[model samples]
Target: MVDQRLPLASVSDFATWEPVLRLMLTDGTHRSAGRSARVAGRVSRYGWSLGHQGSLSSTRIAVEDIQRSLARGGVQEVAFSAEIQPDGRTTLGLVWPSPVVEPAVGYPDLGVLVLAEGSLPEPWLRRPDPVPGAMPAPSADLELLERTLRERLPDAIGATEEEISAAEARLGVPLSDELKVLYRVTRVGRGDDFEAADRAGEAVGCELFGLEHLSAVDAAQRHPGWKLGAKRAVRTGPGAAVQGLAGSPGWTCFGSNGGDEFAVDLTPGPAGHVGQIILVDHEQSLGAELVADSLTDFVLGRLREDGGDRRGDQLPAEARVGTGHLETIQAAAHPALEVLSVGPGDGTPYSLAPVAGLPRLRTLTASPGTLADALEVAGLPGLEFLELGAREWRVLLDAGAVPRTLKAAAITVRDERHLPVVPLANEILTLWNRPRIVQTLLYGDLGPGV
Candidate 1:
C-alpha cells in the first residue's frame, strides 16, 4: 500500500490515469523501504502531487512529477526506470548508473525509480525496474568487492557500457545483481560524481578493503577455491602502484579468499621483493610443486643482483637444514638436498642441501627417523645444526658421536630425559660444555613443569 502519484500526458491521456500499471521496484521492498519512506516524506514536504488535468478532468499531472518528488526527498541511492503497461500501470527495474543505460538494467520500459541527482553525479540515468514480486538477485559481497577494486583501479568502475562489457568479456564473469543495485545507488555515470561509494552496500559491512564479506557460497558460485589463487592484479604504471604498510612488495590488493598464496624472493621479509614471483596455486596443486625451479631461479637472480653471499667460495662449510615443511621451506630446497632429520616420532621433517657451486654442504635435516639417525648425521665433519630431542640424545650417546664441530643447534625434549656424560675426555661433556654455539631452547609438553 505504498502511495505514489503520476501526471497525465494530456486531457486525452486520461486513459493512462488508471492504476492498471503494476509497480515494480528497482530495489525490492526490503531494500527500498527507507527510500520509499524518504521519498514519500519529501514529496509530502514539498506539497507535490500528480493527478489528472482539465479542472477535475483538466488539471492532470505528468510522470515527471514522480521523479521530482523522489529528487526532492533527497532519496538518491540507485537509479530506476518505469514501464507503462497497457493496463495503465508501470513496472520498475534497477540498474547501474553508468553513462549508458544497458549496463544499468538489461531491458528498457520495465519501470523507473526516481533518484536524487547530486547523490550520484555521474552522467547516468535511472534504471528500469523489474516486474512486481520478482525475487531480487543477490550480489551483496561482489558489490562491496567491486567498490574495493575501484578504489585500487579507478578506471574499472563507472566505465561506459562498451567499456564494462568489454572488461566483463575479458574477465569472463558476469556482474552480480547486488552490484547493479550498488552502481545505481551511488549516482555514478550521469553526473560529475561518478566515483562515489554506494552507501547502501557499505552500511551492511560490505567493504572495499577486506575479504571477510566474500563467503564460501559466493566464491563457490564465482571463482571457487581451486581457481581463485590465480587471479592477480598486474600493474605496469605509477597510477597502478599499490600502497601497503611498509615498502614490502605485498600488493595492497593481495589477499586470501580462505587458504593461502605464497610469494618468494631474495629479500629478508616473508614476502621477498628482489626477483620476486607469486605462487597463486595452493600447496595441494601440481603447479605449486612444479614451481621449485622458479624459486631456484629467483635465488640465482638474487645472487646475481646482490652478489658474493651465495657464491660457492663464500658460504659456510656447515650443512643447511629446515625445521618446517611449510611451502616457504619446500620452495627453498636445492638439488643436493641431504641430511634428513631422522629422529623418531617428533617434530616436522625438513631437508637441505648446498646450492651446487656454493661453499657449504656438510649437513641437512630431512626426516624425523630413529634416535640412531640423529647421531649418524651429527657425527659428520663440519656438523651444523642438529634438530633433536631427549630420545635422539640417548641414541647419539650410545653411538659414541657425542659432539664434533657442532656450532648451532635447536633441541626440543623433556628435561627429565637422561643426559649422556663423559668424565675423562668429557666425550659427551664437550657436547654440553661448548658454550660458544648459539643454542635455541625449544620446550616440549612434559605435562606440568617439574
Candidate 2:
C-alpha cells in the first residue's frame, strides 16, 4: 500500500487528482530515456496521455519542462503522479519505485499500483487520442542528435517561431515539419558532425546557414542574371520562386560553404526519395549525391557516420600551409581555424592572394612582403588578430591599408628605432588605442633618441 494521505483542503481537491503513467526506456550506449508511446496503450486500459496536461482532469505536467529535463539526458524511467492544486494549477510529483522497463515490454504491476487512496481502476479513467505535431515531441533519433549537438557546440540555439516563419517566407516554400522542429530545437552552424577540418586545415561538410544567411541568399537570388556557377538561375520572376517547390525535381538550398551548398531535392528521383538532402557543389560544377531521406535523418546520419562521437572541437586551432597555394588554403579553411600562416615557398605567388578566401580567419601570420602583395584584395571580414614585421605594419598604417576588423596585432620589430611614426586619424587612433591593442607585443628592444 503506497502512502495516499494528501494535504488537501477538502475531499473534492483529492477527487480531482489523477495518475498519469508513462513508460520510458534508456536506449543506445548513453542510456537516455524519454516518454514512450509504445507502452502507453498496454500499461493501462486507458490509452495514453499525450499532452503536458496529464489528462482531461486538472492534473498535468508541462511538456516543455519534460523536454528541457531530457535535453541533456540523465533521468531514466519515472512515474509522474499529478495532483490538482486548490487554485486549479497542476502539481506533478515523482512516484517512488519507478518501473524498470525495456522497450516493448509490458509491466502488469503498474495496472494495480495505487497512486492515491480511493483511486479508481485504470478502466474507469478517461483516455484521449494523442495529439500529433506537438512541441518537443521529436522522435528518439532526433532527440539524441539534439543532445549530441548541444553537448558538442556551445553556440547552437533554437530558432523562434517568428524566425522559422521569416525563413520560409523568404525562401518561398514550406519547410518540412522535421526541418522546422530541428531549427526550433537547434539553429544550425558549427556542430560536431557538420564541420571537419580537411588536410589543408579547412572546414569541410555542410555549413548550416541561419535565417540571416537565408535572407541574404533570397536577396541575391532576386537580382537579374544572378547565377550559381554554371547552374540555372534561381527563380526570381513573380510567383516563380515557389512554383516548382512542391513536386518539381529541383534543388532548394538551405545552407552553404562559400561556394557549395547543402540542398534538398523537392521531387523524388529514380533511386532518391522525395525531400532527400544532397550536397550541391557550385564551384566545381559537380552534381549532387543523395545524403539522407529527411532533414532529421541527414543530421543524425552524419553524426552516426563517425561512430557517434566525432567532435570538431577536437581539431587543431591553427593551420600552416605553403604560400600561393590557393586551392590548398581553400581546401583547409574551416570555422575552427583561428590562425593562418601564408608564406612564399616553391609555388608562384598568386596574382590574387588567397588569404581573403578564408571565411573564419582571425589571426593571419605572413611575411611583410607577402602581406603587402595582398593589400589590394578584400574578404578577410572576420580577421581580428594579425602578426607581421614592424616595417610591414608601418607600411600598412602609412598607406591606411589596415583593416578596421583587426583588433590585436603582434609586430616583430627587429629594430624599434627604425619604426616609422605615421599620422593616423582619430577613428584609426581610437581603434589602435583599444584595450586589445595594448596587449600587442612589440618584439625586440626599443631605443631612445640619445
Candidate 3:
C-alpha cells in the first residue's frame, strides 16, 4: 500500500530504494545479479524491468512496495542505479523526467534529452537537396498507365479536373503526369462500395487512399524525438537511386502495404528516375525503398529489390565505435561523418582524435570512461548535439571547452556516483542560456552490499 502520510520528497531518499535494490541484487535472473559491479533498472506505471529481467515472482512483492512508495509521491516512472564502493559504502541513484524534457521528447524512454533552448539536430533540419536536372524513369508511360487502370477498373469514377487542381494548390506541388492520369482514371475512396475499393486496391497492388487523403511526406513527420532523431544522419550514397532523407515533399503517399505507404517519388535519388515509386516503411522515420522505376513498372510487377548491407571503406554518416561494432575510432572517421557514439568496452579507453575534425560531424555521445581523454571533445568543432557521461562532461566543463555549436545535449549515467547529474545538466543549459533541469537530491545510506 502507498504511504500517503509520508513526505513526498523521500522518494529521492535512499531509504525508499533499499528494499527494491535488495530484491534486484538478490533475485535478478542474471548470473551476475548479486555480485555484479552495478545494478540498474527502470520502474514505471507498467511495473518494472531491468536489462536482464522483469518482475520475477519472488521479487514482485518487494518491487511493488517501492513502486507504491513512488506512486504516492506522484512519480510515474523512475530510473535507479546502484553500486558498492570498493571501501563498502553502498549508494543508490534515481532519475525522472524534468519539466524541460517534456516537450523536447515524446517520452524519456531511452536517452534523456538535455535540450538547450528547444534546438533541433541537423537531420531534423535536413530537407531533400534540390535536383534540378532530374527526369522521369524510362519506364514511365502516362498513356499506358492511364489506359491500363481504365481497363482494370472500367466502371470506376475518377476525380474531377477541379479536384486535382485544388489538391495541387493545397499541397503546393504539382502532381506528376503519371499520378494525374491514375487519379483521372479512378480516384479511390473508402466508400460504401467495399468490393469496388478492394478491386481498386488489387489493381494498385496495395490499399489505395482516396484523392483527399494523399499527402506529401516530409522531415517533420519523421521526428521520433530529439534524443534519437537528433542522433540520426541522412546520407544518400553516391550510387543510391533514392535520396536519403527523413521525408520528402516530393514523396506523395497514395496507398498502403499494411502499415507502410506507397508513394510516387518526384524527387528521385542521385541515380534514380524522377517519378519512381518508393515504399515508405512505417517502422523507419528516415528514407524510402525504391519499389519501381515508374508507376507503370510497379503495376506490371517490375519491382526493384536491394540485397544485404551496403558497406564500403566510405564511412557512414552515422556510426558506433568501441567494442562490438567499429573497434577503433579510426574506422569510423570520415569527412561526411555526422553522428558518432562511443560505448563501454574492455581494455584501454578510446581517444576522440580520429573523429575530432570531421567537418560534418554534429553529434557525439561517449559513455562513462569510454574516452581516454574526455577533453579531446573540444577538437570536435561542429557538434550540435553532444552526450557524454557525467565525468566526461565534467572534464569538458572544468576546462571551459563545451562546444558552442551544441543545440541540444545529454549526459549518460552509469552508476550511483553519476546519479545526480542534474547540476551538471543545468550547467550545460547555462552555457546555452536555456532553462535548467530541476532536480531534488534524495540522500541516504543502504549500508554495505551483500
Best by the TM-score measure: 3
lDDT of each: 0.27, 0.38, 0.73
Off by over 4 Å in 2: 1-141, 188-205, 215-250, 284-287, 301-450
User: Under the 3 Å rule for N, CA and C atoms, how many clashes does model 2 have?
Assistant: 7
Residues 1-450, candidate 1: write the lDDT tens digits: 111222112211222222211112212331222222101101121232221112322222323344453455453322222333222232332222221111112222111111111221110111111122322112124445445544544443343455445533643434333333233233232333423333322332222211212111111112211111111111112211111111122111112324544332212222122222233333322111111112223222222233111113211221223333222333433433333333323344333221322223333333334332454454345433344554555566677765454433333322221111111112333444431211111111211111
CA lDDT for candidate 1:
0.27
Error of 1 at 15 (Å): 93
Error of 2 at 404 (Å): 56
Candidate number of the best lDDT: 3
lDDT (tens digit, per residue) of candidate 3 on 266-368: 8887788888898887778777888889989987778887711243343578788877888888988988888888887676799889987889988888888
- Assess every candidate by TM-score: 0.22, 0.26, 0.82
Lowest summed lDDT across 10 adjacent residues in model 2 is found at: 436-445
Off by over 4 Å in 1: 1-335, 343-384, 388-450
CA displacement after TM-score superposition, residue 352 of candidate 3 (Å): 3.8
| Candidate 3 segments exceeding 4 Å error | 1-19, 27-38, 52-55, 58-76, 82-93, 102-110, 190-193, 307-316, 319-321, 324-333, 343-356, 370-372, 416-418, 440-450
lDDT of 3: 0.73
